[model samples]
Target: MTTLKKTGARLGTLPLAVMVLLAAGCGTQQAGDTVKAYRRSYPTPSTPADFLCPGEDPEPTAATAAATAPSATVPPTDHYAENHGFRVPIPLHGQNRCDGLTVTERVKSALEPLRKRGDFAPQHVQNVLTDLGYPAGKVYQDGPTGVGFLIVIDASPWCVEGTMSRDSTKADAFGGYPDGTGCEPPQGGH
Candidate 1:
């Protein structure tokens, strides 16, 4: 075969290669790395978590601090992505706002039924989220990276981000990000 044809054939298997790598990397979640403990580790400035909230820094007690100013130092037991491949500038958020944990469940469940249809087009996903009570205008989407895409709903108090992957066969939804707008991953604090 010509060099060009050989290169094309190799490229065709790129997706498969990526899938294999990803599968292997996602071994198993650690016991302590449960979603309940997946705290937001973002907004870490020289002054520790002083830049925690974007606006109106609340005087946090031990009770409310868990929801408001979560630890930016302690990481979840499973730092799989960091060790495996992906390196995020900001940390992942937890389900604490706008009833985020519930919303995340709702979004994940809503997508599950539609997964078999293979109709996870951006607009469709947004519409579905809107139907579930979120604003249509606040939703954001990016990419069909291999067989996946990202969806983040600006659920006001928190950003509910969902990553649809492996040709819509699976999805992982979570809450929060340390963005200035309390939504989207634009980098930096609050």
Candidate 2:
């Protein structure tokens, strides 16, 4: 068959334009839609408290401080425990608040979840210390990277009081880890 010459039809750009328009339309979301989508994506975290950034010092709030403060009469258990990822060490001053039995048991319990979480192993060096025994009068505080607390054994000269800072209530200053770098404890005059 002979070819029909001379029809020079122009190609339509409509298909390409439609694709661009569809992309532009879907690119941005409305503010409410964004919020809705965020909620859907994140859901609610299991423990909001656990996720809170251990702000500057990571000290417990006043109420918790009071509860943790050692009293003249030691409780049967002076133990301290937490789900061990890295913990703000119990300050040297706060050491008195923990009864050996309580401290040890609490440490065991605290480490249980951490063990489950696969954080520091229950058999790690720190865990071993607690397992063997914590010196009765020693002090401890978080290590430099602040990943873990360092334990001061036997109330040595290296021993110093935990840093003290004002309480919002003006109830009196409370003890805490001094800010520091490395394995050294925060320096505070006892």
Candidate 3:
């Protein structure tokens, strides 16, 4: 009877151990999925042709763009700052091109110094954008590669995109880039 009781206790622990292992596996899978989705949503820029900023001439050729743009290796990560911390109210209507351009420029200027230093602080970036009267939205950082920073401005009816790379020392802005697309509100609607 003593031997049987010990065997039963061991069996009960086996199920608990299995459950823990399953939970851990699920967490790992979920993290991988999140990283994959982020990469899909915001692809890594290969050349200047892949991105455009206001007042910049279009790339003459893909080859030329690739040759001119500096190359930086960005790593994949499960961590990201999306819809966290700061929240901007979504406007009733979409923003115009001019508004987009204005916010883009402000973001570019704010991040210029950080690019030079080859360091990016998410909170500082957020504050600068918010102070500039622009919806900071969400900022995503790819570890510490200094590959650059991606700022998604989803301020109702308008979602402007901005990217900067410490390696390239360039800040590119996309005003009203996702205008027609069905981009959900960044603030989850006010």
TM-score of each: 0.40, 0.25, 0.37
> Candidate 2, after superposition: displacement of residue 26 in Å?
7.4
* lDDT tens digits, residue span 57-95, model 3: 565488645433333222324233222312222221223
Candidate structures ordered by lDDT, highest first: 3, 1, 2
Write candidate 1's Cα lDDT for 114-175 as tens digits.
Answer: 65575657677667767877676443344553123344554344345555543544433333
Best by TM-score: 1
TM-score of 3: 0.37
Worst 10 residues of 2 by lDDT: 163-172
**Candidate 2 CA-lDDT value:** 0.37
Q: Candidate 2's error at 36, in angstroms?
A: 1.9
- The reply for model 1, stretches above 4 Å from the true place, is 1-71, 75-98, 137-156, 167-179, 187-190
- lDDT score, residue 142, model 2? 31
RMSD of 1: 23.8
- List CA RMSD, all candidates: 23.8, 17.2, 17.7
lDDT of every predicted structure (CA atoms): 0.51, 0.37, 0.52
Residue 124 of model 3, lDDT score: 65
